[model samples]
Target: MTAGILAIDFGGTRTRVGWYSNVLELITREESLSHTEEPINAVIDRIIQLAQKVVPDCEVPSAIGICAPGPQAYTGYIRYAHTLPTWDNIPLAQRISAAFSNAPTFMENDANLAALAEYQFGAAQGADPALYLTVSTGIGGGAIIGGQLFTGWRGLAIEPGHIKFPAKDGKIYSLEALASGTGIGRLAWEKLAASNTPSSLRQIDTVDGKAVGEAAMQGDALALEVITEAGRWLGLGLVAMVHLFNPQVIVIGGSVVNLGELIFAPARQTLAELLIDPLFNHENLLKVAALGDDVCLTGAAIHAQKMLAS
Candidate 1:
């Protein structure tokens, strides 16, 4: 039987696992959101159990690849977790590696893996230099230079969301604090509260990002305004990235992209206006990620395969 590999995409709220082997030529996958309430050990155990169930009997995976949230230490332990607090300082790679007969396991930031997926199989395919930015609850980004993952000096590079930029109010804020899903919702709530501007969003009990997006979709003027403003911030961030990297393509994904043209339209407009150098304005430079949710999982599988081969 051909060697098998296990791929895990561990997120703040959910975890997805996939089993792959050359002999099967098909991936068996499973997902669970219940992991949020469980401890780190419990979550890892559950993932291992799921992987065993999916793998064909008598076949052990040669390696496992994990795509996790960032700020991991040099030893592969997460120093701190802004989303999944329970995983803070956990020796995730060591524990997961030990659980599987001491098989080698590789881990990378989720956004970086997403970019790798896009470069290998999604929107950035065939693009030598590309940027993959995910504008979700919080923004995260990764870069591909010369068609390889461009992890920075300390492996914590390309965090576009953390880059400080000025918002409309002239206050400097990180790109994520200004344009992420949560940021958009915060803008909507603040706008509604600061001004008497009536909005359908006010009727919602909670003014979260999804509610704001939904309100915008329903043609609420205030919600649309908030989204547009957030787009401007996103555009500003992209402009900086473009100037710095001159990427051939920028692949955008995440839950917020569901707003579609409401966000992209304004972002495109702003990007066009802000770009002073003609060298960066290539046609079709911005595209949505084609691999969708499976991008990270696919990347993890590929990474695991490479690790096992090496």
Candidate 2:
């Protein structure tokens, strides 16, 4: 019965749809496995159906905001997403908007939306130039500048995860390959196979970045070592980001963020060890997301609001 927003945060493995008031308060939401393996049309159908359940009785939402993976909404075309190979040619914003009485639609990469959410309502909280990193299965990030989301060059800028690194295993690696959650789990297994070191990770049934953090919390030497190594790489990536953007505030979020200071401490050390000059002046320049798991969803609403105001 209310005219609000239908916000969608679409990821590789999950798709979240939320109902929010025009003022940006979440009223309800639904989550589902993305099932990208299915036909592309079916995936879109499911999202539309979920919207029906959450936004009850509204003939049309005031607006719609969609945060999808990979390329931005430039021309409403998704250029690439390894997880969504079939989505490249579709004008997603137009399609979704058409579904809701052609409600005004805004779309962007999930990381960009997350940064906007933080800048407007969460940790960044009005910092002039802010940056956000979501270091989960992979590292994804975006930036905010002059109190607005800085989605440069067709909304393709600020992909901090892909920062370059020296060649490894006959191919050059990016920051995500070395410092993200997936990278942490991969490193743990590589270490387990290569070293005779004793650690609690050997006892876990499934070892992921989360398990590594739990093990490290329990004082496991190898687990702690693996975290430190990942943190150092993460720090190296941060150093690169700092130099590139000189952001006033940097907010780190996502599953890997739960690794907490065990990772950040070393990242900070690396920042101190490298970096020709100091840049941070804001208090807690690097910190966890205040909004937690729902950052992207909140961001979707923020995007919707921004689009409405414009």
Candidate 3:
């Protein structure tokens, strides 16, 4: 019999389930809408039903692992998830374990799982002490030290997006509030509306990061200005993290990374400018994540394997 572990990647928009053996092979793939408005138990039941359909022949998985949006307990319970409603203080691990009965279940924040995936198989492979940053709808961060997920006391370490950035107005704002995708969109909308910047983006009415990228690529000066501002903020946030951890590698991921050099070039330049030590200025220390979408499932399998070993 082929031994395998079941993995679930639960996001705000969709839920994905798959199985993995030694290599992170996809046995089956199933997705369901993440109904954030519904109660936590209702969402759990939907996920369980979907998992049952995919692995009907398997009696029990070696273990079950979940990657969820968090404020979750380091040990297992979910304290709160911003994307999902009313999930505060829910015993998520216990509920999932009850569903399996025989199999052990484990859960971690999605960003942490992404970091684990990078450490085990992706950009951070062979790099001890690495950091992963996902800059998308919202910014999320995770870190691994000596090949172990560095979840600090109560598992809430490496939340880099929450770090404050000094503003020109003499007040400070969080990286998420200034540089996240949503923040970029809001900034573009406000700036374009307030000024007579002659650009295609202004005609569209609805502004988003994708639109901002497209405009920048098309040589819209205002778009380039806005994106550079976001990149600068992101770099400033990473500077704090780099000083604190001094990780060997930093992996940048998520939808916003699609901006590619438009974002990364400015971010790298700004980071180098802010670093105080000449020792920290180096190439190959930072790179984009290579695993893409399968990262969470891969990390979940790794988490399950660790649980089995423990």
Better of 1 and 3 by TM-score: 1
Which ten residues in a row are the worst by lDDT in model 3?
Answer: 71-80
lDDT of 3 at 302: 84
Better of 2 and 3 by TM-score: 3
- lDDT by residue (1-310, candidate 1, tens digit) is 4568888888877778888774323468988773667777887787767666666676667777888887563246776656876666788778777777777888888888899889988899999799999999999988999767888888888889998976568898898988999999889988998988889987879998899999899999999999999998898899999989999999999999999999998888888898987778766988999998888888788777765667
Once fitted onto the true fold, the runs of candidate 3 whose alpha carbons sit more than 4 angstroms away are: none
lDDT of 1: 0.83
Q: Write the per-residue lDDT of candidate 2 for residues 93-195, one digit (tens) a residue.
A: 8878888889888887888889988888889986768999989888888898877788886668988788888744676788887888788888899899999
Q: Rate the local accuracy (lDDT) of all candidates.
A: 0.83, 0.83, 0.82
Per-candidate TM-score against the hidden true structure? 0.95, 0.92, 0.94
Candidate 3 lDDT over residue span 1-310, tens digit each: 6567888887888888887764666777787887867877898888887777666474677788888888564567666666765767777667766776657888888899999999988999998779999999889999989779998887788888789867776877889978888878877887887899787896886789888878988989999888988888888887888888887889999988888888888788887898889577579877999999878877887887786789
Please list the Cα RMSD from the true structure of every candidate, rounded to 1 decimal place. 1.8, 2.1, 1.7
